[model samples]
Target chain A: MTTPTSRTRLSPQARRAQLLELGARLFATRSVEEISIDVLAEEAGVSRGLLYHYFGSKQDFRLAVIRHAVEHLVEQTAPPAEGEPLERLLTSLGVYVDYVLDNLTLYRSLVRAAAGGTDELRALHDEGRFALTDRIFREDAQGEILTDTPQARLVVRGWSAMAEEMVLTWADDPSVMTRDELLSVLALSLPALVDLT
Target chain B: MTTPTSRTRLSPQARRAQLLELGARLFATRSVEEISIDVLAEEAGVSRGLLYHYFGSKQDFRLAVIRHAVEHLVEQTAPPAEGEPLERLLTSLGVYVDYVLDNLTLYRSLVRAAAGGTDELRALHDEGRFALTDRIFREDAQGEILTDTPQARLVVRGWSAMAEEMVLTWADDPSVMTRDELLSVLALSLPALVDLT
Candidate 1:
């Protein structure tokens, strides 16, 4: 009989990605504290020892999951290359709406982790948000859409916070408003927000 | 010793409020699924039989907790009687900020429940939001701030959603922004949002 190949044959990146995806699904359905390493290992078809071997501990596993979610959000909402700053911002908002609708479970998991009082988890959550805010600030400054200053930083942060809250509400009720309708509202409000006038 | 007063002597409203307050505290720290009638009774320092006698069932108890949180939010954010519509709206936002900050644990619990897929819970969540949105919409309409139609409703929903998300972010990091800062941002943006001209 041919010798069976080892599970380690899979690359580290692929394994990490798989673990994150599984963790998101589980965390979305139940509280983080309620989930156990044994359940995760069983679900993943890996031994409990192997699961711990990869993630080190349950908390580390959660952190990895949060990082994955953040990375996915950043990739989805990256600003477009060629458009008016306003148009680019609207496009980004549209992307966010689509992401939230498609991944409500994962998005809620991310929001829960961020909102809960875990410093490391909170830092991971802010990483993606700050990145998106920085890009918006850069584009607005380049196009003279906003005055460059420390105060402008607050505008970006405020806008980001508003957009996040809007998405959460939308996720709660898709029938309440279409994604484009929501984005249009933001687009109309953004010029005033950035003080384009 | 004198016999304890019968259940008839206790006001139902007061008893219901007591159960809700206890439920909120337990749910905030633990999963809803993890919380049993027995545990809630024990935590409240009441007998399990009395707990059931008050709430009727676990589901009813959960609903009561959600309703209590919603009512508390409404009470805090009631519009100011004598002010410019804009001022009233901003004042309302400030009140909301204060409520969330003061009741951080309970607010977080309500948010988590709303995000979870529970229809009754979500309706309770939206009722509070709609109450705030309706006030803003009426102000906008009376001031000729926004076109009166479904489109405007979408804008109101978006703005309300953004406000909710901002509160969650603020709760996570109180030092990052102040209530005044948030109100100022909204005050500037609302006109652009509500005023079609």
Candidate 2:
């Protein structure tokens, strides 16, 4: 029933990756609710059946793309294993800001998905935040494994939200200050905010 | 031509306010996109024609509800006319927190509408944010009007977003801390974060 001209020449893994990349690109600027599987398949030059064959459903595909983006972020912003605490923190912050600046679409897409009011998206976002906060706390504590108390959890969660908003605001309008100035402000603010609780 | 049983027996202004109140209650938990005009009208026990007659359209009614909510917030949290700068700021923060706690539904509705991604909603949200930030800045300045630089605007906006997220998180799970503890953390954090820039 299928014409040879319409067939994708890539292998299954390559084709799946291709579709996911296309999904990330489109979802970077558009909401998941707005994009349909048919249109996504059409845009990717694949059949809807093929798209479904790789990912069981649209929700499954969205979750896959989210995981892909989160892994990319964690890899890109991974902190140094050994450095001065403050220096390591600053470097990590710089890496974060740089990544956002370099990949505005991907960063925005990730943030929007995190805040898009779904259990899966929210859980994925929290997973990323917990990893980042744990790193920061460990770095600040000089490798001591601190107790993850409710109070500590609350402080880190609050700090994470603040950091996210700061980055989002700076990304939306870098005219407020140079990237360094924005980074410095965030670095100064986070420790003080986290220490309050 | 009209059935007496289906008519609302209130003055036009009263009927309009009734419909708007209904809208606020519904929209607090539901997005405008999810709620239909006919559904809203039916919920208010009025004809769709009467609902349209008062507000012209669904979007118009939504805007009106947003304005009403913003005005209510402004009125509720309007800082005391006389107090020390920090004192006044804390008082305003307390009032704001109390209002949000007292009227979670209305607060959620306003925040959702502001973040609902339409141009109109974004603009309305900006309007409310500017008003709140301006008040905060003026109060912190202690009766002196400071220059509203882009950096200042960015900081206040970032702080506002942080406050919103913290309150939302706390509201969703008060087991983390008491309302007073959460408020104290926010009150302590905002100044430090805003002072960074």
Candidate 3:
């Protein structure tokens, strides 16, 4: 029999996507600081120069992985259009919690990387948070109570951080509180924060 | 002419403290993952083996740095004992904000390291949070309105996260809102969280 072929060339777009998928898997448990470009290239079965050619640099590659994961999350957990503002928020929160719990490792690394004080990662993380905040604000604005102003968005940003902490704390130890209770706590806090702002 | 002395020998305790101080300064701008032991030893003018002798591993060294910083923060921002529960909290909040704003670099690295997902650092971060929560809870409990219980402490824990986000957000960009406004937002949210819990 002929020797088996080891590789098939992929289109540029397909190759980048494939590499990002592998990078995401590695980044799930480890921060970019812990993983070297050489290791990433080896893991993807490409030369280090190929990695550089494709992504420009390790930092650029890390950003791509994060952006890809965030886009995937936003798509999967996009809230339904038809519900009361609170109802939509609760539904979205439930889906978010499920997603977070399902990918605890990746979520942990995302938080770790975001907090690592890198300007690029911090900006990416903030963009993701603001996107969710905007969604919630849009729903809340529809209720005709809180107008979608700069101040309103700022409040939503703070609320988003609280919600994040709620999910993270619960995911860290679900035994401490029921999921329903956790969701309720976050939901109840939102209106008060909105009113305060 | 007598040979000029370049350095002096120090006691073990003083030497360890000196090394930790140097390590903390470096760590303020970089995560432990990014700072190698060799660099640290070289910066301290000590041998790598001496560093190993002082700290079991890089992880151990990181914990010591974090511990020292936390202790220093607690001492400097210790809330006054004589005031209403809410009054004490507000005063402590001001002091806490000053401390954070003053040591922005170290605080950033501390938050970064804590979220870096290491068990030891996470434990240290949690302990620091709990200590602050306990202080707030003691004052709140004095009012006999919210007794210190596991459930009550849980609420404080969640509140602590929000307060942390508030402080971090403020530190990241002071132009977004006045310091008083941020503190007010946090202070107002406290009653609602306590009520819900």
Candidate 4:
């Protein structure tokens, strides 16, 4: 019997992971709404039934892709534990800037999603935000720059919003400022924001 | 003959303004989606026909109310022309914080609207944002705290986002920080954000 699409010899788990990676890759450049099951299955060389078997539904597939991207952003931008506090923050921020640039379209979608995405998508976005905060609190646990206080937490949360806006604006138009200039504004502004508080 | 709703002996323009004012007042406490024409007519003591006559459909009424709120916010937050640069920024921020506090529900609605409001409502929000930048640029025209460059415009734009997030967070939970404490954090942040760049 001739198969209509390529069927890899991977395990079910590996196949699922591979499909999600493909979904994420597609989602990065375009919007989730535009990603069709037929297209995804065609791109992944899988049957439509297999895509459904893995993801349950189209919405489920989109959420998984978004979740994957959020996890990647959190994992990629984490600061090394042993570095100087300032260096760690800036280093993570640099990775973050690069991450957003690589996922520029997703960033735009995220802004829209944060404003009006589904409750599921919004909850995912919230998890991503808290992941950043938790990452910072880990450094704060070392008693380096930030102290673990409610006020500090608020500042960090607000600063995340600030950084997101700055990065988004810069990414939308890099001609407005050099990447380094944007990075400096972000890295320094956190300390500057916390100073008054 | 007695009118079922309260109809004042006012001119057409005056009555229209009065209806819009009542709409704005109700919208502040609740949401646009929840504000029915029947309830509004009852609240303002105007006939349903008159409400429609003044503001067309329900959607038109909703947009007008949102636009009214945006205009009031922009008009109320503009800084005085003759003041120290830092003082002007702080005073405007102070008023802004109070404005958000007084209109907390609308502010919450605005955040949602910004994320997923109709194009018309989003454009109104954009107008309010630009109005702040224009207010600052008016001062920048005198060669004050900012030089009128594209970079400066971007900075101001991002700073407004930063300030909005900060205010929203604090307003959501005033127990996190006292009012003045929040104000200080906001006022110090812009200069600090600009210092590095």
The digit string of per-residue lDDT tens for model 3 on B1-197 reads 11111166779888888777777778777766766667787777667898899988877887887888887777776778786766666778888898889878878778777866477888889888878878766667554436665555666677787777778776877877788877777776777776765
For each candidate, what is the lDDT?
A: 0.70, 0.72, 0.75, 0.77
**Candidate 3 Cα outliers beyond 4 Å, as residue runs:** A1-19, A29-58, A142-145, A149-151, B1-60, B142-145, B149-151
Residue B184 displacement in candidate 1 (angstroms): 4.1
Judged by DockQ cut-offs, the docking class of candidate 1 is incorrect
DockQ of each: 0.21, 0.46, 0.41, 0.58
lDDT order, best first, reads 4, 3, 2, 1
Q: Lowest summed lDDT over 10 consecutive residues: which window, candidate 1 chain B? A: B1-10
Which residue window of length 10 is worst by lDDT in model 3 chain B?
B1-10
| lDDT, residue B155, candidate 1 | 58
Q: Give each model's clash number.
A: 2, 0, 0, 3
Candidate 3 shows a clash count of 0
Give the alpha carbon lDDT tens digit for every residue of B1-197 in model 4: 23432745888887877777788777767655678778788887778998899889988988887777788788898887777887887888889999998878767776666556666877777788889877777775765667677777777777787778778878878998998888777776766666667
Which pairs of residues have clashing backbones in candidate 2? none
Candidate 4, A1-197: lDDT as tens digits: 22332555878887777777788767666655678777798777778998998899988888887788788889999998877887888889999999888878776676665555667887888789899877877786776677778888788888888788778878878998898888777777776777778
Docking class of 2: acceptable
True contacts kept of 2: 0.49
Q: Please identify which of the two predictions, 1 or 4, would achieve the higher DockQ against the true structure.
A: 4
Which candidate tops lDDT?
A: 4
lDDT string, candidate 1, B136-186, tens digits = 767665754455566566556656665676666667765655667767766
